[model samples]
Target chain A: MKVHLFIPCLVDQFTPQVGIACLKLLRATGHEVVIPTNQTCCGQPAFNSGFREEAREVAYHFKTIFHDAKIIVGPSGSCISMLKNHYRELGLIFPESVQVFEIVDFLSQYGQSLRFHSSPQRIGIHDACHALRELKLYDQPRELLKRIPGLDLVELNDGQACCGFGGTFSVKMAELSQDMAREKVKTIQAADVDTVVSLDGGCLMNIQSTAEGMGVTLHAKHVVEVLADAMISTGEQA
Target chain B: MEFTPRSIKANFTESLKDFTLRKNLTKATHHTIEKRDALKAAAPDWNKWRDAAAASRRESLLHLDRYLAQFENQFTALGGEVVHATTIEDARSKILDIIKAENGRTVVKAKSMVTEELELATFLNAQDIETWETDLGEFIIQLAGEHPSHITAPAIHKNRQQIAQLLHEKMGVPYTEDPELLTGYARQFLRQKYLDADVGISGGNFIIAETGQVILVENEANIRLSTVLPRIHIAVTGVEKVVPSQQDYANLMRLLPASATGQKMAGYVSALTPGVSGGPERMIVILLDAGRRQMLASEKWEMLACIRCGACLNVCPIFNRGGGHAYGSVYPGPMGSILTPGLSEPGNAPDHAFASSLCGACVDICPVKIPLTKLLLQTRGDVVNTHHKSWDNLAERSVWKSWSLMMRHPGIFRIMRWFGARIPVRFHWGSDARKLPRLAKETFLQQVRDGRFD
Candidate 1:
């Protein structure tokens, strides 16, 4: 299968390791992963800020970049939702765009045929607001996470709550963002899991940054990173 | 008393951290959610009803001018006058004009937030009109000289003991902590005001465009007396409150009370048309814009779909702990966070947008499913774009300058990360007590050294 990687600009700049993990994971599953170098920001910042004109430019750029791919996959749930759900509002502006999928959604459908070695570990899942509320990707990611043998999925309280990293919202409304993030971190800590996993990188970054700042012991990782780790371990065992 | 987000956060954090407040909020929200769920379950075609209600509202809004004209014609034909007040001052003057004409000395009000918005009681008092709040909770808050804490439950933040103390001091009623006794005293005291008042003022929950009727749903039935016994009744409501028909009212009836008070039905769902036979001699409906028309033109026009059930208020995390006063507006909680800025001032409501945790609880509990969380995000964007745009512009320019510089050279970007990873643990951003976990000393690529990429 040919899969085009839309490495979100944030990942490319601040967290390239997540993109690398995604590439390794997809390749490990025997799919040809293509990186579109021209891929840039998803224009969520502009779009959410009501800069519809600038967002259109970004959306057109994205459609042109991934126009030929059979499947477009990205690690960020929010960005993917923008592409799949909101891009059509541009109307005849980017008509040639292909379907986009969050990494969890792509894996949930295709990874069913792949084998994995399981580990006995308890993990809590945090559902990013856009993925849960906008894309309705709640059950799919958790289902995919459960596919790994010996993994116990713990439910975090208010799991669907936003992690308070609403892009520029955190910086502009710093105090309120901190308050909300603190509550999220508190919920994750109460879950008493060794790690918190999510499909959205923005949420992970917010939670991770907050948890790191607080010296809290909870580890946060993207769902694809966990899958990649599992596949690596399984291959080593095999 | 406008609540900014900073104040709400401060108050909420103070309250949420308290065991008692958390327990009360959790218990109240859980109970409300359960009741609403049960109500939804009982109505087999609940979504169908919601769709019908939404359709009715949409139709009413689309032909608002026509229905309003029809309403005025019918109301006037029935010997009732319709006043079209484009602003709060106009609404107040019109009401005062009636008051002066009738030589009305005492007025009774039935818990109208519109009146609160217009500061009507204050205006009337300035003109020497004696106004009494007939709703039990409103009466308590009025005596206490505090604004309502919740839309339906005006004094929800006040426990019975507090009410007993307020009543004991103001009305010289005995200090009894019993709700029934307190309510009974309020009833007895307000009954005289209701019967003797020359004019009655109430907020319409819904205006039935079909019959030109004003509907007021209440638990205590005080509004019924307020409208019936008085020589005149003035129903002040936002233009968005109009609905197409009685059937639309019926559909909303299924959701409002249950969502509001966790009751299957409110005590009274009074629908008063013009010329109520032996009721008020004159009826006047005051249609107020008060920034509603501007809100309708914004991206958040759907917020007008709110039915004011107070369900969103009950389930909102910030509203529950911080209480209603913390929001500082007549409308508090999730709905207030969106509506206040739209209704009052937009750029001034920077704090309200940041008040939510974006928990999505309010969205889930809404009878109409208003997409509250998304709206909050949009409002947050508005707050930033409108209020902090200059600051953001400067910071973003600098950050993007750095980003473009790094992106221009991959070697520099890699080197920067290497150094960033190697930075001392103490240098990380955030609270001093909270330190980031030490980064892995080596990159994953280094750990996979000599591994074949091909």
Candidate 2:
């Protein structure tokens, strides 16, 4: 299988490890991966902020850039949702040849034969709203996480609620966004896992930053990063 | 009093500072969610029922003018008066004229959101016609001289302690924190107003066009009293409230109670057509347009499908945090955010549309399937287009423009990628509470090019 990696702008800039982990996971499942260099942002920021015309130019470019790929996979649920669902609003359509997959969905479907060496004894899943509600990828990631040997999957309270990192909404409604993130962190604290794992880079970044700012001792990481660490094999646990 | 300066950001910031109010709102909203969830889960056919209700509303709204006319004709034929009010002011004046025509000195009011929209009680009081609110929650807020904080629970923002305190301060009731005691006091106090009042003003929950009947549901018997105890009954409701037939009304009733108060049925459900033997001799129904027609004109007209159930508010995170007063309008929460902007003057409640996170929870929870988040997004687009460009809005627009430009050009993206976190400032609210993750040292594109994944 041939897969084109559409690393979201946020994942490319702020969480490259999640992107790399996605790559490793794809390769470990015996798929040929191609990194598309011409790919830029998904135009969701412009699209969500009521700049549809502006969003269209970038979306049009994105479609052209990833036009030849048989399969497109990304580490971000939101960006994938934008390409698959929201691009319709811009009067643009993806080529029927290109099938887009968010990373967890890709892994669960393709990584059946892959084995993992667990590093984290306990992990908590932070359900990103877009992944949970939009993509319906809620259980797929959790099921993938359970595949890692000796890893415990702890459920955070109110885990399905939004972290309020709604692209521009976090800044536009900063106070409310911060309050919501604080509540989420408190819920994570109650779960008492070593790290809170999520599939969306936007939410993970927001939670990581909010936890740091508030002096709360909480580690937030992307789900694929944890999977990559767990799949380092028996001898790689130095 | 005006709710605020019409800026949701400013209002939300101020509301955030009030810990007790946030806690109270959270408590109330969560309580409703628990009850609603249990009842909803118990019904295996809840979604089917919701579909039926939404379908009924959609059909009614598509032919709203025809349904309203049918209602008027049927009602008039049944010996009832139907007054068409094109605006809030018109509705108020028509109700006032009815009261004056009856030579009414006292008005017993039930829970009516349309009357709230009309500000009828305040207007009548100014005219020296005493208006007594018979709903206990309404009665408490009326005594305190405060606007309703919620549509269904008028005084939801106030707990029993605060109500007891307010009642003690205003009505000379014995100070007690027990809800039962407070309710009893309010009932005892309002029992006389029920008999003495010559006019009863109630809000219609549903208007059946085929039967000329007004359907109302309430846990308290106050609405029933308001319908029967007074000699003259004036039911004020929006034009969008009418349905085609009694069967449609019955289908919608299945969802209304479950969605509103999580009951199999409300404590009382009353349907009145007119010319009842011992009921009010003169019954008038005021059908208010009040920006509803304008809302119905747009592609977003499906919003008028609302049944005033307050279900959307209970599940709305923004509403839970800011409370109803933070919205500063007659309607509040997800539905209010759409309604206030749709009905009011342009630039009115400008920031209310952006108050949501686009979570789509309200859309799922809405019994009529209003697509609240989509309407909210459309409203945001309207606001952004029509907004008086403050420097902030201009700057924000410019930022989005730059972002789109960079996103379209990979060369520019590569150039900006070099400057990294400092170039964009990432999260704009850095000085406030939230902090954003620092940009990566080398982007994934660079890493992949350098064989990092190999």
- Please report the candidate that would top TM-score against the real structure: 2
Once model 2 is optimally superposed onto the true structure by TM-score, how far is the C-alpha of residue B440 displaced, in angstroms?
0.5
Over A110-187, each residue of candidate 2 has an lDDT whose tens digit, in order, gives 888678865547888988877776688888988988988888899998787778788778877888988888888989
Taking the tens digit of each residue's C-alpha lDDT, what string does model 2 give over B1-454?
Answer: 2456456787788988988888777788788778888988998998998898899999999998899889999999999999999988888888888899889999999998988898888899999999988888888878888889889988888776788899889989889998888888888888999999999999999999999999989999999999999999999999999999998998888888878877778999999779989899899999999999999998579999999989888888888888888888999998998999898776678788778877777877899888786688678777777773767668878887888888888888888767774565655353365656777888888877787666
Candidate 2 — what's its lDDT? 0.85
Write down the TM-score of every candidate. Answer: 0.86, 0.95
Off by over 4 Å in 1: A9-21, A28-30, A37-40, A45-67, A86-97, A189-192, A209-215, A232-238, B1-26, B41-44, B354-360, B373-453
Q: A26-70 in candidate 1: lDDT tens per residue?
A: 776678987766555676666654444456666766677667887
* Candidate 1 residue B405 C-alpha distance from true site, Å: 9.2
| Tens-digit lDDT string for candidate 1 (B45-107) | 878777776677667766777877776676678677778888888899989998889899999
Model 1 global lDDT (CA atoms, 0 to 1): 0.75
In order, the Cα lDDT scores of the candidates are 0.75, 0.85
Evaluate residue B305 in candidate 1 and report its C-alpha lDDT on the 0 to 100 scale. 79
- Residue B324 displacement in candidate 1 (angstroms): 3.1
Candidate 1 i-RMS: 5.7
Backbone collisions counted per model: 6, 0
Worst 10 residues of 1 chain B by lDDT: B428-437
